[model samples]
Target: MMREILYRLKDRYHFGTPTFQRDDLCFVTVKRDELRAILTELRDVEGFTHLTLLTAVDWLEERLFQLTYLINNREANLTLGLRVMLEREDEPGATTGDTIHDLWPTAATYQRELNEMFGINFPGSPRVDEEFILEGWTDLPPYRRDFDSLAYSQQTYNDLPGRKTHDPRDHMKKALYPTYLKEAE
Candidate 1:
């Protein structure tokens, strides 16, 4: 039953590609416009009513964000992974983002999280601007593949106020024996 829908997704949407990478999982890709329909059918028709998780992947050089929504229908013991991409263009951004809050109320939280973490706004998913996970962030979306976490850690986050830090590897001998100015093998 659900397999037909999966195939229709490929035939219906242009960018609705599927990654048959592994037998256990298949990700169905769809456009922003088609997301609502695809997700609705997956839930109402196929019984995939549970939204498992929502996350975004950053393809830095391509300047695209991949948003993934996982649905698990325990009754059928099946999972459907829906993915969509948002590209940053040179022109002005549109406020109409694909939202599934109408179909799955729980989707609101995921949408909100994506808005804050990836800077991918959900146009009309009530309280879209609400923040939950990260607070006091004034920089680029940290979860995007482009946002270098290590660099941010080095720059924005400092370990201590002004501690003279030593390399743990170099201090290994000292760490091994507090007094063991002992033997070296």
Candidate 2:
């Protein structure tokens, strides 16, 4: 069923090959310019009524940001994830994406969050510039692969009073298999 749909749209949109992750789920990469049109057709004609999510992945080495728009056809129990890649810029606020809030109002929230977290601008998205999670965040967007989380914690937070850090592997092993460690020793 999903393959048939992709075959029909493939000729028209020239999107990348459909990658079927499951019987009900498929992902296809679409050009940034064609995303809005493809999404419109999916919603209006293909019976994909729900916008499940809109999320971004920062590909630091590739210098790209992949935006995935997951749409669902509740009646058919099918999900289609459309991926669009945008060039990642060195300067913050340089990478931009089209706002799909007009298609799905919930998309505005996702776009705002992406703008705040990944430094991906979604122009014309409602409150895209406003802080969605981080307030007064002056450093690099926290979600970007380049962001140094440990460095940020070290710089921004002081050590808690009488707090001791433990190695995660040892802590997890001790918590889950206390007797196993004693037996191994």
lDDT of each: 0.72, 0.93
TM-score of candidate 1 relative to the true fold? 0.72
Instruction: Write model 1 residue lDDT over 1-185, tens digit each, in one string.
Output: 35665765556555555665454456777777777777777788777888888877767688677888888878866677888778853222232257788887888988888787777777888888866787777766776666678888899776888889888876986887756565543
Please give the range of 10 consecutive residues that has the lowest summed lDDT in model 2: 5-14
Off by over 4 Å in 1: 1-5, 8-17, 21-24, 89-96, 154-185
RMSD of 2: 1.1
Compare the candidates by TM-score and give the number of the best one. Answer: 2
What TM-score do all the candidates reach, one by one?
0.72, 0.95
Per-residue lDDT of candidate 2, residues 1-185 (tens digit): 88888887887896887889999999999999989999999999989989999999999999999999999999999999999999999777899999999999999999999998999998899999998789889999989999999999999999999999999998999999999999999
Most lDDT-accurate candidate: 2
Error of 2 at 159 (Å): 0.9
